[model samples]
Target: MKAILLHGVTAFLLSFSALGQMQSFSLQEVKVTGGAFKNAQDVDLRYILSLNPDKLLAPYLIDAGLPLKAERYGNWESSGLDGHIGGHYLSALAMMYASTGNAELKKRLDYMIDQLAQCQAKNGNGYVGGIPQGKVFWERIYKGDIDGSSFGLNNTWVPLYNIHKLFAGLRDSYEFGGNQQAKQVLIGLGDWFAELIRPLSDDQIQQILRTEHGGMNEAFADLYILTKNQKYLETAQRISHRAILNPLVQKQDKLTGLHANTQIPKVIGFEKIAMLTENAKWSEAARYFWQNVSQTRTVAFGGNSVREHFNPTNDFSSMLKSNQGPETCNSFNMLRLSKALFLDKNDPSYLDFYERTLYNHILSSQHPQKGGFVYFTPIRPNHYRVYSQPETSMWCCVGSGLENHTKYSELIYSHSANDLFVNLFIPSTLHWKEKSIQLTQATEFPYKNQSEFVLKLAKSQAFTLNIRYPKWADDVEVMVNGKLYPTSAQPSNYIGIRRKWKTGDKLSVRFTTSTHLEYLPDGSNWAAFVHGPIVLAAKTSTADLVGLFADDSRMGHETKGKLYPIDKAYMLIGDTDTYISKVKSVGNLKFSLDSLTLQPFYEVHDARYQMYFQTFTQNEFDAQKAKQRQQETEALAMEARTVDKVSCGEQQPEVDHSYKGEKSDAGYDDDGRFWRNTRSYMSYQLQNKGFAGKTLEISFSGNLKTEEVGFFLNDRAAEIIAVKDRVISVKTDNTELITLKIVSENGRPTPRFHQIRLMK
Candidate 1:
């Protein structure tokens, strides 16, 4: 049994709650013995073992002034987000250890804790981090020399966010791996952080929170639970971002323009803080956030956002058009939030979204045959996805992907007192050692509609077995030993079977599901075919899958292949009511829709596929086709004219351009675009390879005044030829590469820049 040693007092689990409503079983208690989830977990283990611990530990050692054991891994690890992956690796190892009891995972987890402890010891101030110039950076923050922006603090990339990964990893190491040293290191680090920020006012902390800080509040809350320390709890409360929380508490939808994953972790932290403090407002805020994202912002596959930013709830056109669709990290954090809500509220409805995301987004993220993590799961009709190579890719998704599949059994079965709640239908064996009851769930799940549960008890005991009837299922039939058992359970409710179990008892459930077309949340013509919780998509093509396996380049996770014209994509033309009826069963979990063959989205990989399709009535098909063609022609022509474009405030585009600035900040505009403005200067290096760039076009969120801003190409003043409709066009001489700089003239703040394009 894995247990956290809380000041020498044994806490049975990290999530142990005294005010239990519905509680999840520990990863150790439920073992996924068989099924697709088990396979995914096994594949994840292989990837986990393939990683070198020494390389991951290099960042810590370098920060601690220790001898080098190995060089740090490249990509994000060596980039500004240094040691972020290392932190996530620790978490993955701990959870995988607890879930699989894998000896190798435990070995790696122990090694990480030992190395981190050494680093913490060397600092002598409970401070250890891999942010470049680590000592200098913390010292500056300690002295209140803070320069905060959306993704940068003091001109460094997300230092708070980077460090929070370590905080989370350390917490998970103690909670899941039961590593005693981790608890001490975590407490020490918590103290160091508390004291470091002690001098700063709440306003300064809130300013720092503008950057993408992970669940720091949650980490402090976890520490408070572990040690019963008032300081940690106080720090957690103090650091909670009020700007985001206040709107949520008031039931306002202010999330559309925010960074999706960044806000998700914050909400998770909010939920944790609410749980610890029993703050009803905070709890409601968390629930409100979930409801908005899951109902309004989320897509058919339980993923949200477009290009890592939450698109406007009323307009999802960007989601269907962008190659950078919903990010994997968003759903990963969403699941964490959902689980917290489900456990707290005892609402089985939370499991509906959980199950959908688990089956579609999370399951489809990893390549089955060739184990690689995915960063973006594009919803564009024919655009493919890019998978992350273990050595080269260290995107945020890779970090979350490392932890995604390892603990599939975490929520299969939850309990309240003596009553057992089977929330998910995954095949797993649950050992309730406290009650001496062993229950095994066996099923093919979506492939087959039936699941069988067998129980083995040491002695006869009367208890309630509550099996969730998922929201997707129309109706469920329960049978005991091949005889019908009466059930009046409705969808999204649980059917409880109260009985006195013997040594051997059997309960079987059969469910009925129907194929349906789920339209985009914005009520657009685009829709995805969903059968129960499984989304069905067609493998459109395998050609032009460039960078299918990612390279070490900063933007390598993007699919740079040809984006097939949206107008030419396969569309459903006919009666809307007949779409579902036209889907003929070709095989199990596979269907034939006209000439296209549809299968479970989780089964589609290594190819360009279509999840969402535009539907049209037969009479209006020609007119819509003509309209789409006109739009596509203009879009494609503009794409062909562009040499390179930089999304000014976005993370990847700025990072890829070697973005540098002073007195610069970023924000999302009302029209659903990100913009960056600077009082001093901001510059990005754009490639003019082939010396084909003839014009520079800069777009702003507001009207641009030429007199207010100065444009320079490679430090030389550029001649502005045209300024019209928030766009400035400047003549550009042919140069192989140039640094484009935007300066605020006479100390006036520059107009918010939305995009910079180098046109040929």
Candidate 2:
């Protein structure tokens, strides 16, 4: 929800050059005094406090030339993505300190910075990282011995993306926590990073950018601002991927089938560089990307993608079919993009999207009490989410989740040269020491439609007050001192009130709230109910919420519970308006349906729930019921007859199934289906315990080079006599474990493999 044209790009670009020269009221000027956000922040702070700082610091200490006082946590920490969460913790703690001035958080931030500083000092060359054997890895990469992929570089798990976390963390520590030592350490690390690629040509860096180097561009831009170094600025521009940004700037939507989270953060850096360099074309490109994603790509709850990739814009059936729904990290980055766009354009649409996403997605991602973080919020009917325990889970979502709640107070209030803009109604206080004004806002928000703002000043002053008019509200009312003020302000814009204001001046505004039906972005019949900005959902059942609290498994983020048939789930019978009208609010944020109670998604926890439901008219419902029942029967029969299956080329499945390969590559087709093939060979180890199946079935496309594929099972040659309907069914003897491999003749490539399963 950044900018929707409150001002043109020309005006913004013209003033952008001066942006680097001027500074706003320091971020320390505002603090979260009270409200839902403050409570959530407090909960996050408690969760962070429960984690042993020494254990979290183990990786940095190990990398920095210090002794580890604790063992590394399991799951991703013990896995390849080690040291990532430590970076996120530094950022979250620093942000929490700035937002609330919690002394404990400050101590934690200072401790982490000090530990990392020790690591940097010992490295002696401004090099500080916790990627296991990072010295050797980067040295190899520095010498141009690179083997990179989407998630790996030189056979290591995204060390660049991993280290970017620390770069951003150190920057946040210095910027937010005011650690002077962090600034020096941060610059040192940036210098090390810059010089690491300074020897390589832009072509080599572009090739390196193909890997998911999370926000290296944004981090470099921040460094440029910090030291005013031209080299860092050039490095930021060079780090950007032209493949993604070029099409976007030309308004070409080349984002289909691309990794959604990987690209959004890159576009955010594009916007930042646009503002810093006064390049309006890049700014326009970012705006287009935001609009494309927000309007077309996003779902009802303000989330986007399925299986962590952007599904086709013309089709979202994949979204409903998969247990892995919209990722929390995607929304977190989208909010960042929205905030950046909002700052330059003064657009209300940006804040509107921000409020919707913040409440419905970001706020809903955290476990309110048990202190865990949710990775994927599945929309599939009767499917549940898995929560990450602090000691076990180290997912990317967990890292972003730690920072999400701490950032609620970031946009509550912003200002101009003379005017004060109240962007959000979150109950917080903004102290403008330079202007001698202190504004305090208090509201129950989505539950209560009115918010009160109190103005306190040392003396009388003249300035304008711009309050946002949300699109969800109707007949927005503005009152000064309990009296109706005469002003006509349209929804989805800022309503300004300018006058000489004295101390203790009270301003109140009320927004009329109502419920509406939001459909899937593809214009499908499936829809979710929304009461104002909050997405309202019903708890369908709690049966079989497997892994509600996750184990320390690699695939713990996925909801592995049984997907109660979509056809059997709650069906909103009636027309769209009828469904909306029938939604009855029981009390507070809960709504009553026939067999379930609908509540805000953030409030519905630890249960199986339905956010989107199938809607149909009377005749359509009856007809679809019979057709859907048949499809369900066939689908279930197929599932019941299968032993174990692996989705080829998908990240989680490949790794979980022990995928091993040489000279192999993975990619998606135009229809967003992933496939993997190898020039040398590739294989997967799957389960076949107590199996009666005698056939191993492998699916492939008709368009691939399949004739020369040599099949092997348990290292024994298996004859694939002929292909039947694009599937090669190899007769096999049943065993406890099945090892399947596909090899090619000479150096030729194998066919694109889609799925491998054991079938009766």
TM-score of each: 0.96, 0.93
lDDT of 2 by residue, 144-195 (tens): 7765556556657667878888988999999999999999999999999888
Candidate 2, superposed: residue stretches over 4 Å from native: 1-27, 640-644, 655-662, 683-696, 703-707, 711-723, 730-741, 758-760
Give the Cα error of residue 573 in candidate 2, in Å.
2.0
lDDT of 1 at 606: 88
Which pairs of residues collide in candidate 1? none
lDDT of 2: 0.81
Tens-digit lDDT string for candidate 1 (619-689): 88988878889999998888888888899888767877878898998888777788999999999988887
Best by TM-score: 1
Model 1 lDDT on a 0 to 1 scale: 0.88
Q: Which residue runs does candidate 1 get wrong by more than 4 Å?
A: 1-20, 701-703, 719-721, 731-737
Alpha carbon deviation, residue 518, candidate 2 (Å): 0.8
